[model samples]
Target: MTLTEKQERALCVLDDLIDEGIDVTNLRQEIHLSNTYSYDAVRTRLRRAFGSVENALRAYGLYDQTAEPERLELERCFYIDQDYRVSENRYKSEELKELYGISEIKFQQYKKVLLENLEREALDIYVRDTFPYGLKRDYIYKHKLWHVEKYLRNFYGHSVRKLCEEWDFSYELFNDSYSSFYITQGHIFEGLVGEVLDAIYPGRVESQRRIENCIPDFIVNGRHWIDAKLSEKTAFNRASKTFSKYLKHTENLTIIYAQKSDGVYSFPNVTLVHISRYIPELIKIHRSDLIEKINAFLSNLKINIENVS
Candidate 1:
């Protein structure tokens, strides 16, 4: 059960980074490894180290506490590093793909591994109230993609470019890789909204359709245009800037956002009634009453219809 020199080194670096609240995306660049360590090499060493630890714990009847080796590795590799750019919910970084030989099939396997042994209660504690921070505690209580919430807060708290500079990663490259993750989140948000709409009026929701030069997210009853905005506060300014292009003066458009923010959005010359609310509210009432409320809400917005036809 003796730890390999590389395993010991990786763990040491990992602990240091966690203590410092440093993001672990560019660990290889941030810390110098005596030996050349590729993504695969580090992963292999971590796996072996985890097995060693688990075996030692088992010798003392503590194996059950350490039964989740794969999950433990993810906590060390992803959570401890606090790197939200790529995690279970996001697309893996290219370097990670190359390091782990992750194909489409392997990606699913990797996801399965990280998802095992995760407890929502622990994650709730980690986010709702500050507990003594430790990877061991996070592993015991991780909510799915807790890192994303952390990253959003970090990115909003300061300039993303400046933070990326600290890690020697290109901000543009990081954003590009992260756009997929962002888009995936958007899709999930939109899907929830769509379900609510469909329940009200079946077969009336048109999605991802191009009208004129703009493709709107949803068109209800061949008249009402709706766009769902589900973004962190950090991306609000950027998202607001692009709102005008899709929303014309003549378009019957309404925008619904997931979160309420004290920050104001600078809308274009166009006048529109945009509501800041989430799906939970929409799903709270009886289906018949919910439908009436949704229609009433959209009607109150007084959207202007564009003659795209």
Candidate 2:
């Protein structure tokens, strides 16, 4: 696509900002503050020209493979923020997919790359901040070593013991600050589930009900415990352990999962329900407008569970 005159101007401003090491996360704001262009006018023109601000950045070489980690993170965060803005009813799922060039697998791969880069950056910062005098083997302690071991095994396919020998960083002090840095899909899904429950049951729904060491996502009618999970059935074993604790407090437990499954899962005192199924059914009966929000949230996750029966 040929760049419009406004887009060309915007790109020039962006280039100057990048050269000056100014933050471009708020691209519209920066553009407006830098020039006579109205903020909304620039945003609208850019969207009309490039579909999204992120796409414009990509076309302008800001998302190049050799881009600095800071630049990449800023670009990705802007992309994600734009996605959330549109997903909250500015556009439908199909429109979002078309505009963002997103598919389920592709989005997942993009997130994996983003997360890996963030983890590497976090690790570097942690080491630099904690060990200003350089790391020594004798100064390390092995507290919660298994947690770091499992994290490395899952995310990096590296063995922690070998990694410690190779990298000279304490497993105990290497905090995975990803959760602290970003709002994860799990947290968003749980919040969506709470919204749906509140819309349907109103005054009868209680959120994050604590029962001893366990806290289910919600309790409906003060009897039925509900948990919202973002994973597919592969999380059954882990969820089962938590559900077992929930069942002791309630007669039945319900799990509202985001991903689709092949068959209905069976568990003692538990019912497995896909969010697609549960939300649509309630919307059919209650006629709640929150269905659109739920659909949009699922679309952002690139999870097409809308067709599940």
Candidate closest to the true structure, highest TM-score: 2
List per-prediction Cα lDDT, in the order shown: 0.45, 0.55
Task: Quote each prediction's TM-score.
Answer: 0.31, 0.39
Instruction: Estimate, for each residue in 87-206, the C-alpha lDDT of model 1 and write its tens digit.
Output: 342333344544444433333445555543232222322321221122222442474555544543444342445534443333443343344444454566576567776765679998
Candidate 2 C-alpha lDDT tens digits along 236-283: 634455556567788888888876656656778888777877666675
Measured on C-alpha atoms, candidate 2 has an lDDT of 0.55
Q: Pick the candidate with the highest lDDT.
A: 2
Candidate 1 — what's its lDDT? 0.45
